[model samples]
Each structure stands twice: as structure tokens, then as C-alpha cells.
Target: MSDSVTSVEAPEIVVPEGVRLEPERLLDLYWYMLLNRRLEERLVNLYRQGKVIGGVYRSLGQEAESVGTAYALEARDYVSPLIRNLGSILVKGAEPVDILKQYMAKGTGPSRGKDLNIHFGDLSKGFIGPVSMLGDMIPVMAGVALGNRMQGKDSVCLVYIGDGGFSTGASHEGWNFICAQRLPVILVAEDNCYAYSTPTDRQMGNRNMVDRAVGYGCAGVQVDGNDVLRCWHAASEAVSRARSGGGPTLIEVKTYRRKGHAEHDDQRYVPPGELDTWEAKDPVARYERWLLSEEIVDRSQLDQIENRVRAKLDAAVDEAEKAPMPEARTALDGVWSTPRWTAEHPNFHDFAAEIGS
Candidate 1:
């Protein structure tokens, strides 16, 4: 059988229960999903052309999970995005040009080329930079949530972790701390069925990861990660509950990464017919069909949105390419090692001065 997934007749568009969104709002959701798809596709081209630094991690088949959960956040809320979560960051107000520039390691990028691709964050936009260590950000997000609660703000923090990362020690420790404190946070495990090249079965014995939440003393719900509306509904409920002092919620988003872990991996480990199955249920295509059948958006409108997204992506790439590389001396510009060392042991620096004398 060919590896390509045939686009068979799509399933019916089921409006998520209790969620009432206008047509315009529905179109907005579709726009973000399309934008994410186009942006990642462009990144792949850039990676192949050797324009991007390090490896290009993509959220290709996981757009619905990212966008839907991000859209549920309020402006005051915060999020800790994972490696494959460009859509979530974009929905939180990150400029695509900045994202491209960051990947290209341009002088004007968020980290001024002092960092790896897509590993910087803007706190102004409520996004925390992704750490290469999987599952480490869970505690960071818990701290952010604690800060908000301490300040008397009803804001919640959302953190994304992959199925592979969810098994890490940091994931369990972070959740343990947050649950004990009754912190306002939502944790979404994007179970894409693979931990790098390893399958979930090899990584964890349990079939459904959500069931683990029972031990953590929090509500856990699973969602169809490919269906944007369904994810949005689940996220909306979790966010509402957290903001209202309902403690934490663990949400498992069932999705897949059609591409390799990064551009470097060939994804040969993926079983035959698995990729085809997911490609047929692509979130962007699925949502597009729903919009058309429901008359929420016509073919012309959808095409127009796609054209705009392509143009925007092209412009972002062009601008990032034109941007200059960072100056070498700027590496020392943001270092704060001395201040932290001095604060930790005030007498240690003075002792060093005495020793020099």
C-alpha cells in the first residue's frame, strides 16, 4: 500500500457540546490552524535550504491541540509551550517574522542569535521559552501560576508536555507540587503516540495517560486533539475551572506528529499505514470541511484566508532572510552569572578579593 493517506469522505462536523461560537469566531480558529500549517511547511523548506540553525521542530499534525488550548487563555494568563507548539505561541501574539528570525538566528531575533531555533519566549505575551530538557517547564509554569494566585489575580497557567515528556520525573514532581499547593494551572499532555522514535507502548504500560491524574488529585479529561473545536471546548472548561479556584486539571490531547521528531530524523520507525491514517484526519483539512459543510465559511473565503496566510509567511521569510546575523561580542551582553553568584554568597566574592590581595 502507498504511504499516502487517501482523502476519503470526511466525518460529520460535530459541534462540541455546550460551546456556542459564532461563524466569525469559528473562521478565526480555522485561520490560526491554516497559518500554523503554512508556517511549519515554510520552516521545513528553510531547514532543507540550510537557513535555519539547529534542527527545525514542527507542530505540523498537532495544530488543533496548540491553537485550541491557546485560544482558551485570557491575556493575563501565562503558558509554557513545548518544542512542537509554534501554533500555541503564535496564537499568544508572537510575530511570525520574529519566529522566523529566531530560527534563522538573526541579529533582530528574540535572543539576538544567542540561542537555538524557536527556543526563546516573550513574557509580555505570556509565553515562556522552551527548554531542551523535556518536562522541566512544568514547575516553571507552576511558579507562574503561584505568582498570579499570590498577587490575587485569577489567572491560570497552561503548560504543554509531550507523551514522552509526561513520563519524566520533572512532570510528576511539578504536578505533585502544584496539586499540593492547589495552584491554578492546566497541564495538557500531547500524546502523539511517539516519544521521539519510541512508541508509547514501549514508554508506558498504561494505555490512557489521563488515568494517571486520579493519583494526582485533580480532574483529568481527554480530547480529540485533531478536532479543533473539541480541543477548544475541553481547554475552555479547564481554564474556567482553574481561574475560579478549582485547582488544577490534566488534559490529554490525543494527536500525532506526522513528521519526524525533528528535520534530522527520517521517521522510518513509524509503522506503515500509521502516517496515512493521521494524514487523512489532518486538523486543518478536517476543520476546513466542517466550515464548508456548516456554511460557516464558503470555499472562496477559505481560499482567501489561505492566500493571506501564504503571503504573510512569504513576507516573514523574506524579512528574516534580509535581517543581519548577530554580532559576536553580544554573547556577553546578557550574562548575569556574577550577580547571581554574588547574591548567593556575599562573602565569597569578598574572600576572593582578600585572596587576590
Candidate 2:
């Protein structure tokens, strides 16, 4: 007898104590978030110094979504984080040195001198290409989960996108198929207020992207992207559902873009008041306050975490700079080195099916 329930809905999981997390895990969790935040700041400096020749989508104030969600996934799970979700990558064990190397165009980068930041996939760690093109990878994520199900593997597929990507027809198509097939894919929508310069209000008809999930026979939840605990809870539930063949869940994280969208955007249109409001709710600060109130950690401990993160960030920069640039010929390398895109597509099933078949 097999425990397979055919329903077009998200699977539910009772939050186990192990996964529920407690103050006992505070130091680890706090440091992880701090480490990622400090890294983002340090990388931005690298970007400015021209050490990072490519570009970056800095999630300056949105650290909670990345670190919290990353903690929920098993080491073997697959994550299709968007460009802005690099924090998620870092949490999935992508080394800062390697990340900096990619930014520096180093040969040892996970992309192997191919993808310079955007296109990302690391088999060893199970985190795949950020795949910048929105809606492109949502269905692909579902397909990965489907393959895992067929192979009797417990891996779950997570797809990440932004507010801008949601406007595309692909979001609709991807969710529809995921529902009909009941694949285990989690779509994390980090609504960072602005998609480039256009505010969410200006870009989309409805402010809440989470509401759209209901139409597709899927479940979606809106959580405070800056609230680490909330993010962890939501993602953990989604992970449980997917692994149990519950199907896909969409999580719309309400957060703000603390950076200028990308390295190039000036973001001059942003009003000062709006920026100040979000800045006050900075996830790091919120989490720290919670830690203090709960006595999970104290000021000295928090300070130590900050100092350590800064040191690591500094070391990553040093390592990145000492790293060699990808060979001068490497400029042409990223787009075509792999035959995955060159081959004729078979029916989109496994990633191999989508490409090699």
C-alpha cells in the first residue's frame, strides 16, 4: 500500500520540534543572517571598486527571506533562486569565495567561467542557476520535483521569482501545470517593493501577488519578508508538503529592495519617507530585538556575530581580489559552452529531458 493522495493543493506538515526551531538555535540563525547581510554589503563595495566586473541584484534589507528559507531546506534539496535571492544560495553552502570569484570572473567559479552571476546551477550543492528570465524556470522547478517523485527520491524543487516576473504569461502557465500534475515545487516571490524603478503598485494591477495562487488551485501565503521566524515557518511547511507529494506552494514575501535594484540603477525616484520606513524594519534589527527580548542572545553575543561576519566578508573580498580573472577569452564563454540549450527540446520532464532527450 502506498500513501499517495491526489489533490490539487499544497501538502500540510505539522511543524516538528526539530524543525520548529528555538532560542537554542538563535546564535546560529542570527549569525547566518548577519553573515549574509555583511556579505551583501561587502560585495556592493566590490561592485563599486570595479572588482566585480559583472552586476548584482543586492538584497540589502531582505536578508530574512534568503537565510530563513535556506535553513528550511535539506542539504540535498534543489533551489532555483532568482538573482536577488543570492542570500539563499549562500545559505545552501555556496561559498562566499566562489560567489566573489564568479563576480570576479574566476575560473573556479561554479559556472566554470561560463555564467557570470545570473545563470547559476551547482550540482554538488543542489542549487541551480538563478536563471534571470522570469517564469522560465518555475515550470522547470515543477519538472524537477516530478522527476524526483518518479525516481523515488525525496528532493524538493524550489522556484524563486520577483514581482516583475509575475507579470509574464509564464507564471500562469507554470503554476497551472504544477497544479494539474501536483508537483513538489515552491515558488518564493520576494516582493521587494520595486522592480527596478517601477513600484509594485505601478507595475501590477493588484498589489498582492499571493492572491493569484488561489486561482490556480494552489496555496499561497504572504509573510513579512523581513521577519526571519515567519519566513522559516512558511518555507518549512512548503518543504514538508513538496517532499510528501503535496504539490507546489507560492510564498509572497512582503519586503523592500534596499539596494538600487541592480548595480546600475540610481533609484532616484524613491521617496525618502518610503525608504526610511522600510529601513526601520530592517530584518537584522527586528531579529536582534527578538533575540534580546527572548534572552536568546545578548548584546555582546550579537556584537560578536557582527564582528565575525565583517571579518568573513573582508576575507572573502581579499580572496576574491587575489583570485585571477577568467581568461580574457572567457567573455564569449558563458552563453554557449553547454549543449543543454543547443539541443532540440524533448517534452519538458526532467532537466535532462528538457535538454538532452
**Positional deviation of residue 280's Cα in model 2 after best superposition, in angstroms:** 1.0
Model 2, 349: alpha-carbon shift in Å? Answer: 38
Model 2, residue pairs in steric clash: 120-128, 120-129, 121-129
lDDT by residue for model 2 over 284-304, one digit each (tens)? 887888778767778998888
Q: What is the TM-score of each candidate against the true structure?
A: 0.91, 0.85
Q: Tens digit of lDDT per residue, candidate 1, span 50-109?
A: 999988887877999999999899888888888888888888898999988988899889
TM-score of 1: 0.91
Candidate 2 regions off by >4 Å?
1-19, 328-357
Off by over 4 Å in 1: 1-12, 338-357
Model 1, position 45: C-alpha lDDT score: 93
Candidate 2 lDDT score at position 356: 62
Which clashing pairs does model 1 show? none
